[model samples]
Target: MATFIKIVGSLIETLQKILIQGEIDEYENDKQMHCDARLVEMLDRLSKDVQASVKFSESFLIEKIQFLEEVKGIRLPLFIPHSVFLRLLKKKINSVSEFPIKFVNNVWGYLETVCAKVLIDQCGNYPKLLPSMKKATEHVMSKMKAKFAERVVEMIEMEKITDYTCDPDFISSYNKLMNYHAQFLNLLTSYMSNSITVEGYGSINIRHLSEVPENTRNQAFDLKMMMTTYWKIVLKRMVDFLALQLRFFIQKVVKK
Candidate 1:
């Protein structure tokens, strides 16, 4: 049993290395192996799908504003409520949670393919060992995908539950977005048009927001700008942090 386990471990290590480092000849150039390149292409497509799935709550901004108003008290919304901000963030995160799971599932599936190919190529002399190897690789693939799926769901929940980041870009982006706050309100009241044009944001429809109570408009805009700025940070972190984690994970698995 110990020998069988060691063989599976070695097999997993070999498959992981190939997926991470790609073809040995192209390793220095950082080019993906032919099969691994397909996985990368699929991941890129999944990323675009996730990006399209979640968007600024443009149409729903009024609903969120109304929700805040209903929960308001004597505070006059001097500041955006943390609970409200979290509510929006969670809603946004939940929308795209499945994409990550799908991505990890497909990634492990691709790795299984790489393993099978390697087994076929490397075990050509041991015809009887091929069946056992194929079985072991499939078992490892199943376990790997399940583990990743659970961790990814946990991660998505963490993002929804915790809103913390030290990136300075959030403040800079928020400041730029909020520069149009006064303009947003003015356009809401203006008889000239139903939309406001802000740099970087282009035309934003204020048709629904015009009716937002004066006392709460400031808070609503604050919520919007905060969500806008922080969402960018969240998306960027999801991409950057995942890349770092994946690299570390592959390296750790290979080293083992």
Candidate 2:
């Protein structure tokens, strides 16, 4: 068992190294095609190891939280142990595919709401999450134009054309829409918190490395920068103070 764990851990570590280094290479050289092929190889190896391990013990949640954090997106962590899945299987669950399918659907639904809120905030259209083959940009732009046209019609109907900015009802309606979308986001959060996926394998939220776009990369970088600034101001100050106190305590211990 120890040997098995060691092997699996080694594989996971190698996979992580490859992914990290490949991402850097892709970013620096714009060699996404090469990176994508490497990613496919990595995924194939990881999946095979994961399946073999799961057959032996089920609930092995891989300890790679930092990697996910570095990516700047909260997702279903890979390398789940067989023991965890076994526990879920013992719960008399039906339909193997439903859980993962629903999990993906729910995640996409939550992402859609997030997109809507972001679009509204930026005065852009809520973009749909379609399959890789689908051309969704045009559809999203069209939808945004329609939404804006509808808003214009509403403004005219309300007779607040000149002073629409001052109309509380219009603002309230927009807020209400956002709030409704937020409710869906909350549902996803709740489901995740309750370990629905762990309990039933709802969806395997495996984000492909190839899917990381330039815009998303920029957003992730910006978010990390903001977080670093916040942490430096708050946590860093506390840590420094605590370290000083620790140093004084150690000196006292030495004197004794």
Candidate 3:
């Protein structure tokens, strides 16, 4: 009877051990799955953010390009040479002192109207009336590059706040993610240089019209107008290319 009781006690102890081991194994498996799910969620959010940013950038660039095109179509007389307008005005009017104050105002108004008409006529006939478009494209590209870089930095910073464990696999995955973002930024820079940059200028050059002499101001205005046209064309092309590339990138990230 005593031997039977000892055997039964040993059996009960073995079963209890087995049950506890099984519970522990199950808990560990659940924990691992939870961690993996969290990682997946983080990665998915990051990818979506990148895609959204790209879409926003594409839309913004397209809108800006359209605005520039519209500006190009507007007839602005500011590009006309002041000297030429002044000479024409002198021919149309008598001495300035011969008029009363009211007459002087009328005469100035007439001069402005004639100047605007002549400027429009000349611009319509002459291609050289506009300035260099390269300058405007450069300005847009610079802004794009800067904005893209800033966005990448922001993404990286956000990722650092995610709840990743200090395990080898997690660390490796985080490192790879950061490296990929860095590569993307470098790719953007490369695209800007290869696709957007025009020869003869490296940076945007802006001159204040108020600070320039009247004769040179007209030339400056012409240059500004030319830049607007150039920006429109280049921005359109860049937005198209970037949109396609960003879609491709998002697909690749999702697959990974």
Candidate 4:
């Protein structure tokens, strides 16, 4: 019986190590902030086997999820319900350590991809407005890159807290990374503005084209009026409508 108990304990320990290393490897590969808290929780939980330590670690993870719930104003999915996760961990259930790690990692990956796409799409449309989009792009990209760099540093420190060997070179690279990212942002913004100005100026050289052709003038004016009405009624209203929808979704999913 003692040997059997030891064998079970050994299995659990091995599982914990696998989860920790997998998490660290994923974070290193992705450098996203969303996974940072989850990794810390796993690391802390594995570093100690005491019941209280597990509880504390689990609670920390839950608190982060709660914060995400609040920030995005969206509830977590039902497959990984918050209450269920807490109850499972509190009861010392360990079957799904790998599951939680994988689920959260995938969720974060999706978020990162989508957010980046939104930024890029916005950037793509910047050429239409020239300097405004250029400045906004520069501002947003710098803020984003700095935020990412800060997150990477924080994750590296968190790894060290869990007794992982952090690469000093990685931390040192942050400064160079910041400069390069800023330069890239600036270059892209300038290039976009120049391209748009050239294209727009070229289009303007044809007097008939610069002014709407006589035949289509009325149609063009009508189209503009339609757009104005749409913007006033629909497009403008969607901004807060979406926010409220998001908040409602969050309340429904997380309130219980």
Best by TM-score: 1
Residues 128-161, model 3: lDDT tens digits? 4323222332344344444444443443343233
Q: Per-model C-alpha lDDT, please? A: 0.68, 0.32, 0.33, 0.33
Shift in Å, residue 139, candidate 1: 2.5
* Predicted candidate 2 versus true structure: per-residue lDDT over 61-103, tens digit per residue: 1222222244443444443333332322222122122322332
**Candidate 1 local Cα displacement, residue 107, angstroms:** 0.9
**Cα displacement (Å) at residue 127, model 2:** 83
Cα misplacement distance, residue 115 of candidate 3 (Å): 61
Q: What's model 2's TM-score?
A: 0.16
Per-residue lDDT of candidate 1, residues 1-256 (tens digit): 6655656565555566676656544233534346556765866776677666434445736755776866676664477668778888998898777777777766666656656776675566667777987776566557656766677777888899999999977788889888987787777777567787767656767787676688677777788778877877777666554555455545543443
Question: What value does the lDDT take at residue 118 in candidate 2?
Answer: 28
Stretches of candidate 3 exceeding 4 Å from the true structure:
1-212
TM-score of every model versus the real structure: 0.81, 0.16, 0.20, 0.21
Q: What is the per-residue lDDT of model 4 for residues 1-256, given as tens digits with 9 covering 90 to 100?
A: 5543443344234323323223333234445423335445543443332222222121212343443234332453323333432332323223322332343344334433433433343345344443453355345444544443444334323322232224454334333323333332343344532111111112111122223333233222222222222222321222233233323322222111
Question: CA RMSD for every model?
Answer: 4.0, 31.3, 34.0, 28.9
